[model samples]
Target: MRTNKNPSEPRFLFLITKPSLQSTLLLQALKKRFYNEVTLKHCDVIDSSTIEDGDLLLFDMMSLEEQTSRQWCQDLQNCQKKFKTLLFNIPPHYHHRDIVEWPMISGIFHTETGEENLIEGIRTVCRGEKFFPKSINDYLTQQLNLSHPQWNETVDLTHREKQILSKLRQGASNIEIAHLLFISENTVKTHIYNLFKKLSVKNRTQAVFWANKYLR
Candidate 1:
């Protein structure tokens, strides 16, 4: 509904795995309707260093192999600079939830999602909130709730850890959280490691789910 575009808005970059009519139409629709800086690059040849902070990568999962897509997401997670990753063109019947396991994934746009819903999801993701469908959210919730409640009583998170956990819930990257908390990136990682151990969670998504259930 908000048609006005700002120059400072997060740039949308489409990472095309394979050229298709659907990909072209999606790009054209995004360019015409929502963003001023929407652009496309082949995922195979994209230079990870060129993706800057505040840029969102929309990966076309329609053509990408699952393992290959996970590798790209993992690579993005390992980058020094913070960036948002969104998977689009996901088939409606996609049963693999492992791809969403990456904390770098801020959103997903299914092939069945309408244009308006896609645009809305992108806008929600740009605003720093995860845009997962209810089904994905429920999946994560179930995965995390399997843990014992006694662990929550033994775990005591520091103030900084709590802050970082909150940031993780909002889908912030380590680099982004560091900049936000005025701490060094290494410091952020250290705290994250400590907290992850304390919480008995392995990654950001699990940490966030723990925070959701345990943190007040």
Candidate 2:
């Protein structure tokens, strides 16, 4: 499918939003700041026909109701869209750590900010850089360390593998793990296989019993 391609000029961005006054304010500020420097579009979402390469998606994600936001984040992991998605808000309570927040926002410019800061965030994200609010930096660090144990400097298992095991230990099925991890069921099986091979286990039940053994 043909996207709004213009590689020679400024990058393109699309917003698939549920719509809110705060989102509207942010979009208006972005437009005013980078009128000629960027191309913008609005869609209901990056669906089967949506998303193109070199395009960054600015999701007014928090504008959605809580249950909707959770479901949307779930879909994003499984979505076939090729562009990178940056959610506007991180969950106030986080249970995962591998996800980075700084790459999503640069300098906590509010919808109240007029043109300058809004343009900065757009250009920053468009260039594949993220800016975060100064106020949230410490929180990011605290949350990162709380998710899973880090052995030496690296995770004992790759984050994906560890994530699946975590859910498995919690008694989730492969299908449930896949949905929670935003991976396909086949991929989940592959991860399970690799985990078995890596841990020298024969099956899921064994993996669960042995998962924490590698932590220390």
Number of the predicted model whose TM-score against the real structure is largest: 1
Lowest lDDT 10-mer window, candidate 1?
1-10
RMSDs, each prediction? 4.9, 9.2
User: Model 1 over residues 132-214: C-alpha lDDT tens digits?
Assistant: 88888887676667375534545777899999889888777777788899999899999999988888776677777778777
Instruction: Estimate, for each residue in 1-216, the C-alpha lDDT of model 2 and write its tens digit.
Output: 444334432255655565567567756765555453333444344352454455566655445555655555455444433455555544455322323421222334333444565456656666656565654556555543333343123335888887888976765656667778887999998998987777665445446656655443
How many residue pairs clash in each candidate at the backbone level? Answer: 0, 3
How well does candidate 1 match the true structure in TM-score terms? 0.69
The residue pairs in collision within model 2 are 105-131, 106-131, 106-132
TM-score of each: 0.69, 0.50
- In candidate 1, residue 62 scores what lDDT? 77
lDDT of each: 0.74, 0.53
Candidate 2 — which residues are off by over 4 angstroms? 1-10, 18-49, 87-115, 145-216
